[model samples]
Target: MYIVRFLRCLVLLLVGLATVTHARAADEDLERVAITRALTDYIDGSAHARPEQLRRAFHPDARLLLSRPGTAYWPVSVDEYVGWFSGAKAGQPTGRIGNVLSIDVEADTATVKAEILVPSQGARFIDLFLLRKLDAQWKIVAKTATREPSRRSADRVLFVLSSAKFHGASRLPAGVSFGEVVEAWDAFRAAGLTVDFVSPEGNAAPINVTEAGEFRSRFYDADLMYALEHTHAPSQIDPARYRAVYFVGGSNAIYGVPENSRLQDIARHVYERNGGVVSAVCHGTAGLVNLKLSDGSYLIGGKRVSGYPEEFERQDAAYFKEFPFLIRKTVESRGGTFLTSARDQGYVVVDGRLVTGQNYLSAKQVAQAVVAILRKPADQQPKQAAEKG
Candidate 1:
């Protein structure tokens, strides 16, 4: 009788152990599914602040990997990543990003692998995301990437667009003036910098809303308007977080950007403390004339800069009536040396804290100049090269 009872007790203990083991396996499987779902939602549903989905699946450090395929990688920050989420929610998706081929998750981290084939150029690209979990939550924390087409430089830049309206002319598509600013932006995006847009105020700084009916009647880029209307906020822009600030010009810039003291402060911080390029053109140049530097002197005081020339302003005789004076004269009087084109090319200048360009014609050259300066290694560009080359 004693032996039989002991055997029964042993059988029960074994059964209990098996049950616990099976349950553990099930939990891990569920966690994996949760991870995949969250990442998908982040990729898909993030537009509307799908907080519940984001909270459950991504750890606070969640990030996205965007880059050229097969190149050494760098990823954007969380806030920057989320800006896309908002934009995505507000607009139709442009496959600027390639397909997300896979998501690999481990005990505390994960990685996302993606491949891109762009329309502007048939460039092949690959990117990877590395994520980690804290407090039982998984989040994307890092990104590593590569691109098939080799670049002139290994570094990438993040260009900030402050425009709320697109630059499409009547005969052109919206944001047509994308020019070099947009082109560099596209290049950097293809190379995998999470370039994004945020307005001076949290709202979409109205486009040429009140301007020429023929010129201003249309909406901005549907894609960009989606991004702006969604993530448009001043708080998201922290100058300390970026390497440089690229301000593009729009006629609306005359009225939209000048009044923001905080935006001016961010511009100053990016220049003085972080040492990033602050490039502006046309009406976009107005922001600089008022930015006060650390030494209490205005930033353009002694810098050689350029923007819409006074003559060019006169050329647009009917359009520039609101501006009090010509950029060249105003800057020169303020102790800044102004630059201009030979009337054919876009004119630009780089002097210490300021980088300025002439009219719309000079936009591309100006962007290239800004990128060249920032790409240098720790201010070591053979002084002569920087000054004369």
Candidate 2:
């Protein structure tokens, strides 16, 4: 009887501990959100010349410490900073862009690092801010900034994956192609690009890796594995932060990805709104079939696209039977010209901002194509007409 009582007490203790842990985690997340909002207000306010937002983000007594070429120290008050935008129209662009680089919070205090770009003047500045939680709201208490030559854009690429682990209703296992992921990842990273993973269900994506080698082993590291294990949901993604969206291919790609409306919206925002690239490899092209632009026209319309065509699949196989639609057929039906090369050969089609690969063999090439486009001079890059959706 005593043992039974002890076990019950242990279970209750564990449950209580778990509840406490979850509560603390929730509190931390809320704090982070509040802190981020404060930082965004500061960035957007400066870029748009909004005095009100700047006032909201900073404490009245906040001071900015800066330096001039001849002066050793320059101290500006919050009122002085807000007054600089006194006559400017709110929400008007000031030819300045800012991005939050990092944030660290401890107890009621926080620190933030942000990058501000004045492209018109070819200047970049790193701003460090100290913040405090006051009256349950985060406010900037102090700031320091330094200028440097403009460098690369802080934009990153988002890799979309499937959460489906099984082929349709059958028990046949399906997962993302580890080879395709590794190849494209290698190419992008080599070009100094950051990649983030997202899925429809926001869970760890299953992977299928048939062969392994030293090249593959180098990429299959703890950081990459952790990222794969904790992919963000579509709702959690900020399309403005991504310069491109690459749909990864596998048998699992044909299941949940193409039909997800949120994912499609994210891709559309990245392509049309941000003038970014949309790419796919092998079955990943399946996700592009349903992507439509702001004018209600299909994005792939009249463009050449390549993917894992139906001809290559064994039509009689159980996995093929579970496929909702064939890639080539859907592409054609959506007004896209489906193209391919000989079986197993690397093939890539670059039609403006859309880049598609025929198979896993072409994954690296597809990434290189995107990198080439992105690396182009601002004046030479393709311009996408912005439209409301």
Candidate 3:
């Protein structure tokens, strides 16, 4: 009986300790939330706050930084920044222009990083701070930042499709084939990437069932017929804002994308202005043959590239003659470096910011490569890291 009573007491004590520990955890979480809110409030307050208010976001020893592509790094002490802001406040005219990225905490030391979107000035930045407990208050200690003028996800990425009929250049003689629009849709959607499809004449892009079923089966396949019936221009796509332009080709793309001046313009702008990824497979790459950048340089000039290899022309013997020129010759003539795999094989090329898949077998490879580029935050992927040997 005495032993049983002792065990009961021990159980009660353990339960009480557990309760205390949980309560303390809850309190710390609440504190972290409070800190995040305070920092957000501090930054958003920069929208219109005087120099003194912005200082709250930074510690006395903090520094403000700015970087340019080829110039030396510039760093300013907190006092210098505040003093400069006082003089420039009139011209700078602050507004709501910032984002909270991540807040990581370990014991008493914590790290918070932020991204702020600014215009006129470079808002493309990632700022990291070290926080330490001083008198039970968390204050930022060390700081670093980076900036890129034209960066981030495409202001938009749009997809163009053609009717499924005569897909794979079947209407033409052998060896010439193109991408399938339905597979393109499925690949993009599976990766959580946003996609929009439109037709050349503004009609619904068709889906070829036999070809689509070959890859994705019913579950992964898109209802190309149904999508065409309801397709709309993507609101997320703005030529100036897009960081990448993707062309989804089908055998029908040979007849469609080649003359899409609108898509061509979007592709050229996104590439030149943003250094974005412009990708097409099979016949879709044909659309790029005529595009010229601001310098009047062919967009693909001197860059490694890939598309449906001419070998596929054998696949449909008669189709090869219809194309104005072979895909390989057109790209190579413009001084663009061209790449391919053995006939009907998967080939993907990564040249600077551009990624291209050789043919239908290479769609997912192209999609993953583009995402790798998109998901790479500028700060983490320092410009130097991308430099090839």
Candidate 4:
């Protein structure tokens, strides 16, 4: 009886040892994938100027600690830091350089070091990240960075504001949303990207007074408004001179932009011939509704796209009933698959050289997507457009 009992105890001890060994091996595998995912998220986010990607890479409480010339450590929450990229500067190239230099992992914590270079500004940055595993997901919990800034050549972006006024059916006074244009303009300027304004008729586009935010309201000065009104005509500019064409949105854009043949020509030449990006937000996508390549096929055919949804238009059905067509339905019918986020939240879709923002809220992200594409080497652009024809 004693021999039988001893044998049973030995068997139990062996099983317990094997279970612990297997658990440790499983944990090690999970940690490997988790570390790789976290690092990939950081690289792709930084390269593409995508805050949505950055948001996923970071923990909710992550903080960025920076050292500026005369300041002690300046700490910014991940939420606050991501806000910068969602602005006009959002698409501006960060000129990220280098791969993950190294990664060190111990238990549930890990660290990564990466480098970025802004050749245009002659700046270099080294970023260090501290991440933790929580609930089997790895997320960046802290970051520190050092930058050496220099000078470089600047690229230009054309801001194409809609020149129309009033919603189609009700003829209610409407123009470009104040927040859309001003916010995008501020972002572009901050990113050091040169900007110029254009319109269908080369005249100042009107403003939708009701759409202005506090920052835009305070910054709306006569000089700025006057400049917006005196925009350059499509015929007057060389597409080769610009890196991207951004279509700003307003209710009137749906009516005025789509029918402009010259604007279409400019967008085509820039995107097809010069390897530039074409972008639009909100009602501005109306401009793309009828855009075609040199081959006469629709530009957006087979593309993944997003814009203000058809549901939003129906919400104002009484007012929009007179429009020629809704933006979402039009794009979808033309072979573009439409994507939407929570109504009115910021969302931008990038498919090769084409970028579209869902609404006014998505304007900055659309611009950022454009900037990210432009920052890539010319050869890196998806040859989809070239092959589509």
Best by TM-score: 2
Per-candidate RMSD, Å: 20.4, 6.7, 18.1, 22.8
TM-score against native, each model:
0.53, 0.66, 0.51, 0.58
Q: Once model 1 is optimally superposed onto the true structure by TM-score, how far is the C-alpha of residue 178 displaced, in angstroms?
A: 3.5
lDDT of 4: 0.75
Weakest 10 consecutive residues of candidate 3 by summed lDDT: 380-389
lDDT of 2 by residue, 333-382 (tens): 99999988888688888888889999888989989989988988757774
Better of 3 and 4 by TM-score: 4
Scored against the true structure, residue 4 in model 4 reaches a CA lDDT of 96
Q: For candidate 2, what is the TM-score?
A: 0.66
In order, the Cα lDDT scores of the candidates are: 0.56, 0.85, 0.62, 0.75
lDDT for each residue of candidate 3 in 168-194, tens digit (9 for 90 to 100) = 445532211223455555566554444
lDDT of 3 at 321: 56
Q: What does candidate 1's lDDT look like per residue over 1-389, in tens digits?
A: 99999999999989999999888756655665555555565554443454444444444565545553464344666666555545436544433333445554556666666555443454446756666666665665665556675232323233434543432222221221345344445544544344455556553434433332443322454434444343335565666765566666665455445557777787788888887777787667866777788889977786777776667654654445555455677778778777666665666677754567776666655666666666677665323212211
In order of TM-score, best first, we have 2, 4, 1, 3
